[model samples]
Target: MSIRTVLLHAAPDSGFNDRLAFAVALARQSGAAIKGLYTLYPAGVPRVGRALSIYVNELVREAKEKEGGLKAQFEQATAAAGLAASWETIEGEVASSLREAVAFADITVVSETPYGTVDDQLAATLPEHLAMACNGPVAVVPTGKPVPARIGKVLIAWKPSREAGHAVRFALPVLAAADEVEVFTVEEGDTTTADSGAKLAAWLATHGVNAKHRHVAEGNAGHAITNEVQKFGADLLVMGAYSRSRFAEMVLGGVTASLLVDPPVALLIAH
Candidate 1:
């Protein structure tokens, strides 16, 4: 019932070190082994096209030095955390190596890519990036402040759909870890008519979770869920990452899209 191994994708810059330390601390608490995965792309691609930057070598020497420093820092962090950790430098084709690493470990946390659109691209390309990989659930931790600890209060965004079901299942560990598990369902379609929340509550009872069902009527599901989380003092959220047809998202953003941009609580999503 504990996280045994965690796979963390390290980044080019040192910003990722803080994330790694947090992961290491959690792993230590859970008696999990930490796997340090490094993606080694060709040092310093020409920033501009050959016409503009052929003469500019991009100072690859700086990249080389940075990479070395990063590795040393990773080792130091691992040692400081007092947990088992290993390092692997992969000849990366970017997302491909990440998929492989996620598949190789029990739990995966990806460092956000610097393409200026990783969050948007994450929803679009996650399937391809994961590629039927990852035997266990993965955590795509967005680059920001470190996730808070003592995750006792959790809000489950529930809907009668396969996506929502998978989200709940994938978040079983976290839910089991929480002291308060709120099954927050917003009005959508005939959800209340069919007593969808009751079914979910029964299922959770079978699994020994005393989850409370809260039905929110007449509001946006995403916003309602966020408000409910705040009302209940929830620290973590369990939700499904839903992808709409590219056209639908553009015309009017869906709950998933809105949540991705600004989730009130730390989210654990299953797509």
Candidate 2:
């Protein structure tokens, strides 16, 4: 499906501009409108005493002030790019707010790590949380990097699972627009894996994606995929997100968990 509405997390952190850049590029490619979501967390204050209440109120005031600047920046950027844009402000938990906003978006954009101060531990894994919580695709931009102006080469991390299939289907729009697309799979001496990769590539061809299939025998799937992303110099990496149970993935340390922590490039993922 073509992207029509892009939901972007607008904040005052370092990744805000990068995330916006990525969102603008994607929206431009698909002729989509952008919606900037600015979230406030006045609920995080504890009702311990009056001193803390006053401190929390001051912090909220400062955050609100920052929101004004961020809104201006968003408008200027989107307007300069000639894209239709809108603004929003929500007061609550960031994850909960995004959960509702993503429902109306074709794709949601966010930073791979926390969007606030470095000590904001609650949001350290916001991207992963949204990836699992949302029903649609999430495009996560790398933190503190210059986002690519266009998605030229896309690398798809393939696996024979429903989540991977969903990711491929959700990423069809970007894949079709990419100049080069590769379906890369890491196998352990499994011939069937190679055959499946070829079939997936052929099927993608029917959807107007010229994808090349590649398979390698590697035991560490997470490391292998990240290394391939760097080797290929890919602009974007499309892959399935959270193929395992959250508790199991947390304890076992799967690929989705590792990559979401520190993505080497822009990532488009779905559950």
Candidate 3:
């Protein structure tokens, strides 16, 4: 129920600093330990010639140098924040390494994937993949945006499913601390009861979170959720990820896909 350890993915990229700062702030707020995890690109072997081998070695060296710099930045930031932290480097594919690292963490903080071509598979899908594999919760910070000073208002995309219920429970610590929380559900027909959203709000009330329930008209689930986020001025949006399979989501375009593609705010997702 409490955040005791926060796992942050550290990379030598544009959004790394913002993600690290956000993770550090969350750790400071919850008095949790921060674990900085970096995945090093696996060194490749050259079978052609000595020159190619030398080039490969050079690439590996440059990667290590960059990793060292990133580690230093992470350490300095955590120190400045006065939070207990640790760092580790994994040698393998980024997503796989992150999935393994999330096992020991209560929550994982990652940057939103840059919108573009899917040339970089890991970067494009890391957050979603982590949400599925982490078994806890993954907090995704939007790329190029600094963490908000306060997460006072939160929007919960309620869908009356085991996954959504898990997400709400996993985010209880944050919800309990928020000044205001709204639980919104989009009705696709009579498939969902009229009081479904209110039921979630009532459950949250038991945990001391006085949440307002809103029922939205049937439409695109993703757009409806985003509209609610904008209307409520929510600093954080909590929801379940991949109610469908990843392949299905990728092709069919579900709420998970929409949020990952263009997150309206910081998102806390669980699967």
Error in Å for residue 94 of model 3? 2.0
Per-candidate Cα lDDT values, in order, are 0.63, 0.86, 0.82
Q: Which digits, one per residue and each the tens of the lDDT, describe model 2 over residues 1-271?
A: 8999999987776688889999999999889999999877642345479898787677667779899889998999999999999999987657788989999999999987744564245467778888888899999998876688889999999988788898899899999999999999989566577778889999999999999998997678889889998888899999998888878889988999888878889999988
Among all candidates shown, the one with the greatest TM-score: 2
What is every candidate's alpha-carbon RMSD to the true fold?
A: 4.4, 2.2, 3.2
Error of 1 at 188 (Å): 2.8
Query: Which candidate number has the best lDDT?
Result: 2
Q: What is the lDDT of candidate 2?
A: 0.86
Candidate 1 pairs with clashing backbones: none
Write down the worst ten-residue block by lDDT for model 1: 119-128
Stretches off by above 4 angstroms in model 2 are 42-56, 114-120, 189-191
Give the lowest summed-lDDT range of ten residues in model 3: 39-48
Model 1: per-residue lDDT, tens digit, 1-271?
4577888766564337545755665576567788877655432333467853543333233434566777788788778777788877765544567666665565676533334553334334443245234444555444564565556787888877766677688666667666888888777665462378768877887877888888866687777887897799876677766644534754787876666555565566665
